[model samples]
Target: MQIPWEERYAFMTKTHIETYELVEECLKINYFGMKYLTEALLPLLESSDSGRVVNISSNAGRLRFLNNEGLVKELDDINNLTLEKLDDLVKSYLKSFKEGALEENGWKLPGGFGTYKASKIFVNAYTRIAAKMYPNLYINCVQPGHTQTEGSSCTGSQTVEEAAKSPVMLALDDSGQTGFFYDHTEITAYY
Candidate 1:
């Protein structure tokens, strides 16, 4: 049950600042939508013997994508992370974006796409949190490689089917691994 949405504002960069509404919309679709959906279905998933959650994350979600050392450390501290803290971090990012101070505030990425990157970063973090909270379930996030989707302007080398393999593999995995980030089917460092 994969629900997809086109990121029409994927072209937004540091120089081409997007509106607050647009930035928020990106977060809503990329992060909040997934979060709410998973939470809503958690009970059903929990009842299953092999419940699994394979979040379709991106390489852009890597902690290295962030220029802010503090933020990176905060996100990496999964043991102490809370949903409230994550929400606050996102609100701070939104404030920085609204103030036109993303770069100064260390919320901007090198190649831009700050909003999208931040949203994915949050998704990765939320994946970890959920996994920790639900030890009975297998929860992980995977970077499906650069696929030629509308978001990538069809410049990516891989087709949509090629990109689907990693996530689908993770979804069907019965190893009981949780709170991991995968680069294609292999486990990778989140930081």
Candidate 2:
């Protein structure tokens, strides 16, 4: 009946192989998955005058966690940040991860947190760039706030209902404020 603590932590932590697999899967499911889906639906979205994209983002995506001034600028440059460019940024981040140069290259989130944060950051940047591409459509990123959900590792303080409101509100908003970030319920600059 004596179980080692390492046994408990084993699944919580990961191997180098797991990290690489996770990073790639994270990009695929979080960033590229969204990208391809949106592209596939662009025609339908374009046809409707009320098209809206409310991406469920997180506080982890906030620029304050990034800490790299140069990277922040690149991520925030809505005018010049294209879809192709975003892919390049993701590629560079992955390269830095593999080379053990994350801190040297400016990524500071540390492994899984770094990947999730980077994914959301990519989603936020994509929201900005896409909103610019389709001015008529309402596209924005909404931070659902840390809520008591399975995804939050059960560390959240808010209810699932409370967390759902942010994206739902953004989905229904017609204030003409596209390419913006919402901290739960308030409109704010992401950077």
Candidate 3:
């Protein structure tokens, strides 16, 4: 006999994976999804006379300098520090960003939760570097602040709408500024 429709739906939505598996899955999906989406947007932007590609990053991206302790040191290998490695990563990310694909070449944190923070960090760096490399493109990341969203576990002090204000502002900005980060609709220092 066939299983009930409700049972099948429940099975599909179940979040019973072990912590490790969950993290791996999150990283794989998040990184690859962003890369693919960005890649698709590049061409459209290139052909357009004016356009902007805004990434939804987080305040966690700014934690790098202030909280160096949590920063991933895996990419700090001596070999990775070479100009060649840096150049290649920058070039690859820029090509995708300029073209509209976002391939994350950085390491995925062992736990998927922090990976979001790391992703934001990568996005922030890529934004700054890409802006300089492709002056014609408006590439930037906007921190929505601590908003109460599903991913935020509803623990944040701000509402989802409040958190979204910053990203919305960045998306609508026509000031010609690129590679900038905004916090709650205002320009904020990131990194």
Q: Pick the lDDT winner.
A: 1
Worst 10-residue lDDT window for candidate 2 reads 8-17
Clashes of each: 0, 0, 7
Task: Name the 10 consecutive residues with the lowest summed lDDT in model 1.
Answer: 1-10
Report lDDT per candidate.
0.87, 0.82, 0.57
TM-score of 3: 0.62
Candidate 1: RMSD to truth: 5.5
Write down the worst ten-residue block by lDDT for model 3: 74-83
Colliding residue pairs in candidate 3:
35-102, 38-100, 38-101, 39-100, 39-101, 42-99, 42-100
Global CA lDDT of candidate 3, please? Answer: 0.57
Alpha carbon deviation, residue 190, candidate 1 (Å): 0.4
Instruction: For candidate 3, give the lDDT of residue 181.
Output: 78
Q: Model 3, 10-125: lDDT tens per residue? A: 55336324254444455445444554576588788778766677877777666443233323352233223333444454345344434433324333323223445555665665
Better of 2 and 3 by lDDT: 2
**lDDT by residue for model 2 (1-191), tens:** 63344553354345323377788898889889988888888899889989888887787787767879999998987788998999999998888888888889998674346788888998989989999999989989988887776764445667999889988888788888899889999987787
Output the lDDT of residue 50, model 3. 69
